[model samples]
Target: MIELPPTILQIILNFSIGLIVTVSLNIEVGFLNLPQFGRLLAVLSGAIVAAAVPGRILAASMGLPWDANYAYHLYNFGIVAKINNMLSENPGLSIGILVFTLVIVALIGGLIGYLSAYPALRLKEAYLGITLLAFGELLMNVAWNYDPLVGGTMGVWVVDPFRFVGAGGARFTFAALFIFFIAIAIYIYAELLARSPFGRTLKAVRDAEVAASVYGKDIVKIRTQTLIVGGSIAAIAGALWAFFTGSMKAATYTRLTWTFWPWAFMMLGGIGNNLGVLFGVFLYTVSRTAIILYKGTLSAVIPIDPEWLEYIMIGLVLVAVVLFRPQGIIPERPTLTLPEHKIEMISKKFNREEK
Candidate 1:
């Protein structure tokens, strides 16, 4: 097996998380027509809740000191005396705690979804974005003030699941597996939601709310439902991210870091198509990772920092897509109309949506 550089490995993980976030965003904004500026709020809430719960669960499971037990292990690795002391003292808090911790992360996603309905009141696109952005900032601010939540700026250390299992490189391996499962599940569910009756309703509302409402659709309830579903998926991504990183920090979930890039991915690929969103995620991830990896090469040739260049390229792409291909590279597909049972001459525009 060819071993990837550690930086490459980190990039892969980051890219996966970005893709997941983008897909979730597309489901909400592109399909359901929800105006979400604070998408990171759900992600952060899920991740933090997962981190918080799993640490405690692991502690409770193995009869250990919870978060402190992992610390003890870290110290124990540094010195034989500490190892023997911890073994002699705690004696049995092992890998099971890590598994328990991951479960907490999954549950955290559900919890965020459950709470998302409360914030469903803000429905306007720009307003929602501002609210979400504010929420992300608020989380960081809270972390700064409450040091114990994520160890303040220094950040908290989490038990590496693979490390607990005595595997040298399993951390990335497992993280990849975990992320793959999440992506697959999210893709499947989003697709289902896109194709279902409810999904159609969501699209109708997105395309023209007034028309949908006139045709016996409850806009508020549908929007709320979409928020709950999409937020839940995002929360799941957040939880998986927290576990994969084995550390959660306010900085990780900030607006610039988390929210903006993912949404850009969705826009770049195609707004309403699930596959398009996934493609967007892939494009963003590959391009972003490639630039960062070969930053020196670019800077030597071009007079801009790789980071700035990355943003510039992304912005330019967004502009090109908007002006030339506003529908997106693939474009939002027209909803299909099911055929009637009888052989009636059905040439009445056949529009799936009412508007």
Candidate 2:
């Protein structure tokens, strides 16, 4: 077996997280044609939940402080350290905390989605996008100011559910592998959802809302459902990110990283195509990682700041794709529900009848 380098492992981890979030965005913006400019809301929800909930639960169980003060940096660090110690010794408990956190994140994320549906019904296109974006920013600000929520500006340490795995490279590899596994599962789910009847309905609604309405499709219901599904999935990505990083800060979940980047990834990968999104995410993640790794070298050659190079490169790529390859590197293909032979036979019969 070949040993993977740390850089490669980091790429895998980043790719996995990006894939999960971008696929969730695709389900909404690509398939449903919803302008999801506030993808960060659900992601922040997940990260905040993952950061705030599980450790508190463990603390409470152990007769430690689990109240608002638990999130304070002074208490949070110690509490999380104790929790990590417990988690390291009990693999089963660690797994349970992981599952429990994800479940909570999904529920809260879905609720947020459902709540957004009211505004979604009223706002159209750009207005809706702006509303969603504002909502995410609002949440971020609240979390930042509210000391109880992930320690506000202080941040909080996340309970490491993967603590059972040995420390150093071994632990990082395990976490990366677990995240990759989840990414694959989400991809399969996205693909299946895309092929299902509901998926067809989403595309129909997206392409022609009036025609879909004429066909008796309830546009309101579909939009709500899509938001809930997408929100839940995005929340899972956020939770996984928190777990992988072993820390969480409300300020860390920014629009650029959680919302816009995913949008760029989805656009780069053929919109409405899960496989394309996967490829797009992997390509972008690796490229971004390489740029960061070689920032000093690039800075020596170019006058621009090293921090901005990645953004400039991605912006150029996005512009190039938009101007030249609007359909993306892998264009979206028609989903066929029937066998090729059957479709061909039906087509022939219809032609003969018309003749």
Candidate 3:
């Protein structure tokens, strides 16, 4: 039922957000071999902060009612509308809010990640994963119950930084383009990190913790660092999603949507491979969007309800990937630390010395 342009834009936006989150997951799970089942925690942190923080800052500065209860649904809509109105008039202020929200979200997400390191130090594998999952659920429950924190179960509205683009279709297009730009930036960062020395160290720790430790790598420190980076990045996705949707609900960031879906994307894209993950995200986003848009037609042929069709499709894809192509569509290739020419020169030198 949706029009083609809107559907295409929606797909791009979804793909961008998915890539950001999945790549963040890949950082911890793929590179460090950490079982990060609670990936939603960092994302929730970002969304809650985006929902709660920058809006309040803007509201207070503008002499709006930004009390502790500002996030309550009743007050939230009115205040955010005012904020958007103001932002629409001032492009610089709008951009400032976006930057400010990202910074705060990243810091909060990183803090949570650092705290998670405590458990990471003591627990291994499933235990660590369970602890992280519990952490995410705990935050969700708190946000849902704590009225001041994003209006509790009612959720809260977010400030539209892109309101400066005006109230038109162009706004959606600009937002989608900005989000895609961010996705590309994130992809570049992940690629560079994967090829960096720290990335190699992460691989070493992942492959053989004892060996890496013997080589003077601090296992605990490395994990803490990875979590900090991953958490910050994941939170950015959350904040961006809030901005794009123009609302935030604790209930929206579910384990199924944020955690498991990202895991599936990472697995399908080839875990530990940024480019592979990008491709995987694109494929998944397109397919998922198509199913959602055409669920009415699919419903007549399929026994399942249209509402649950996407879920079933995702589940089936996960299973098929696990059974047939465990390494994903694009399996992870060997990461080389040095340039080919440099390595060739070194090899020649070694050959001459041996002769």
| RMSD after CA superposition, every candidate | 6.0, 2.5, 2.4
Ranking by lDDT: 2, 3, 1
Q: lDDT of model 3 at residue 305? A: 87
The lDDT for every candidate, in the order shown, is 0.67, 0.91, 0.90
Query: TM-score for model 1?
Result: 0.80
What ordering of candidates by TM-score runs from best to worst?
3, 2, 1
- Measured against the true structure, the TM-scores of the candidates, in listed sequence, are 0.80, 0.95, 0.95
Q: Is candidate 1 or candidate 2 better by TM-score?
A: 2
**lDDT of candidate 2 over 1-355, digit per residue (tens):** 2336899898999999999999999999989989999999999999989999998989999988999989989988898999899899999999999998999999998998998898999999999999999999999999999998789999999999988977777778888999999999999999999999999999999999999999999999999999999999999999999999999888889999999999888888888888889989989998888888998898899999877877887798889888988778898888888779999999999999999
Error of 1 at 116 (Å): 4.3
Pitting candidate 2 against candidate 3, the one with the higher lDDT is 2
lDDT (10s digit) by residue, model 1, range 1-355: 2345676666667667776787778878898766677777778877776555545454455455545433333432233223323323332443354445445544555455545555666446676667657766786688655655555655555444444333346547655655776687778878877778888888888878899999999977786677667676777777778767667666767776667777777777899888888788777777777888888898999998888897788889988987988767777877564546332435344543444
How close to the true structure is residue 120 of candidate 1, measured as C-alpha lDDT? 61
Cα distance off (Å), candidate 3, residue 188: 0.5
Model 1 lowest lDDT segment of ten: 75-84
